[model samples]
Target: MAVPFSHRLDWSIATNRLAQALTLHRPQFDLTASNPTNAGIDYPAGLLNAFQDPRSLHYNPDPRGIESARAALNLGPHTLLAASTSEAYSWLFKLLCNPGDAILVPRPSYPLFEFLARLESVEVIQYSLRYAEGWWLDYDSLERQLTPNTRAILFVNPNNPTGNYLKIAELHRLAALCAGNNIALISDEVFADYPLTGDQTRATTLGDNGECLSFVLGGLSKTAGLPQMKAAWLTASGPGAGEAAKRLELIADTYLSVATPVQYALPTLLKHGAKIREQIQDRTRANLGTLQNSHLRPLRVEGGWYAIIPTPRTRGEEEWAIHLLENERTLTQPGYFYDFESDGWLVLSLLTPEADFAAGIAAIHRAFTA
Candidate 1:
């Protein structure tokens, strides 16, 4: 008899044809990459010498992670270190949800979320983030998506691709939503450290809120732009947080996945990481200025490293992306890829090298006008 695979991983290969086509084609101006290393930003390497600490040679593993490293991340007395935010999310799913339980995610957000939920045999319901003057949560639609099976509500503060922040009002509403519901609130704040608009609140973290069981996640991936280091963490706080922390501690301990060198050097990486983060933020501001000066008039990005431009749609969104790729040799992501409810939207990375981003914008302009 043949072995069977799980149905959860079964997904359509055809939906990714545009991406696959561009990959096989000649080198194109890639606007889809958010990876900071390739974004042509300079980083401070002096702090990396901390990894040479002789103590790293000793295998010291803790289920809750090293206290000093957790302190470096601002995760307070209780912290669970994971190899990455991706792994942290996986752990959260394992800790909170049983098979077939559901979680609420944002629509017009990153597509990776649904895949992440699926990996844990968890269902995902997407709530719309209505964009007007700025993006705000569509609470009515969100309430409709919630059910008894819903174990948690996840927010990508300064969400990926759209770059929308969870404002104070939205945070208040969410806190109330989770209050007395016995539900967890997970805020993926990896991009929280990057705010395009000057935010009144400095890095709004959800873990400290005493309303519900909340988790605020971040890492060196975006905060420090060190993807290779593989360091990330989540801070669990709020009511019943202590109990959940114990369970999550056990789950994290089972893997103890983070490397000793990264854990030992996290403090230095973060200290120097701030310098690179500023560089990247400046680059994002410059690109935003370029967009503002042009006819594109991108949607106001409150925070995060990506921006979206609503374009005239002569054709379907997918057709537009393919046209931009084939005609302009400029690769861009279609808005629908993020579960956007509308058409005529193209997403671009602010992290693209300055000149390359300008050229991609020029190409897009030409294609749209031509």
Candidate 2:
């Protein structure tokens, strides 16, 4: 007897030798550190006290996660938690789609969603974001991509690596479009709190958007910078949300992947999460200033942890990334890695340590001005 392995499992590349070298003792400034734990940020005092609490010893497990934890999220009356956002995506895929159903994703965005969809045996449809004044959805292309098999359209609020968010007006339009097409609007708001702008219209979250069947996802990973805690949730709202949430809970009952410790700690963790976010924001804002002193033009980001910078069209993006590593001892993400529409673009993580980030930015400045 043979176990059939899926082709999707074979997909990822090594995360570059520079990252490996940094792990070994090589002197390098990695500007792609997205993990807040690794980015040298300080969390609030006494946060660790929640972890070893006596309450975690109880074996009480709820399929939708512990009630208090889910309630703490305040997303809605309907909520489900998972090991991480990836698991949340998988649960949602199973909840909404048949094996071959497709979901629309944004280009020039993080590559993780494509892999997540593939793992669920779901197809991904690409919809482009035009970078005119700033990154905005291409409505014509979006309209053209929907088909009978399209079950949902996903948006990364303040999208990964590109940082632009869905505007309130755009949300209204998209929700109406989804309502018309019978598609669910899935908003991944992991980066929702890190808005680069103070304008609330551009920084809106999708939890309360009532026009469509909406599933808003987020967790401790981005919210509290605690990926190791393995706590994430999905919230449902809109027409038939009550029934859909019940079905989702039944699916979640099978996996029940969240740990009791993390569940019990949710209250304290979310409370202290604000300080961690503040530290991260301070670093990203300061580094954003340092990153702009060079010839490369930085794209306008309304919010999120990553920044996209434009480079000159001299070589392949990978070759430029290689040059940065070899010559400057600095590492950056090649634009193509994020499915960028063209070359001459690179992504920098605002979560990087300020000194290291500044050094990497200075190196880019040297290359541009040289």
Tens-digit lDDT track for model 1 on 1-370?
8999898888776747687767766536877768898878787757669799888999989878787888777766667888999999999999999999999999989788888899999999989899898888899999899899999999998898778888776787788788857789999999988888877743377667767889888888999999989999888888878888899888988898999888889888988998999999898888888777777879978888888998785787778788888888888888988988988888988888887788888888888788
Best by TM-score: 1
Taken over the whole model, the C-alpha lDDT of each candidate is: 0.85, 0.84
lDDT of 2 by residue, 1-370 (tens): 8998778687767776545545654438888788788878887779988898798888988898898887788777888888998999998999889999999999978798889999988999999887986899887889899999999999999887778888888898999999999999999999887887777667378766778999999989888888888889988999879998899888888877888998989988999998888887788888777766655678887788888888777767777777787778888888888898888888998888988988888897787566
For model 1, what is the alpha-carbon lDDT of residue 335? 90
The whole-model C-alpha lDDT of candidate 2 against the native structure comes to 0.84
lDDT (C-alpha) at residue 14 in model 1: 72
lDDT of 1 at 162: 79
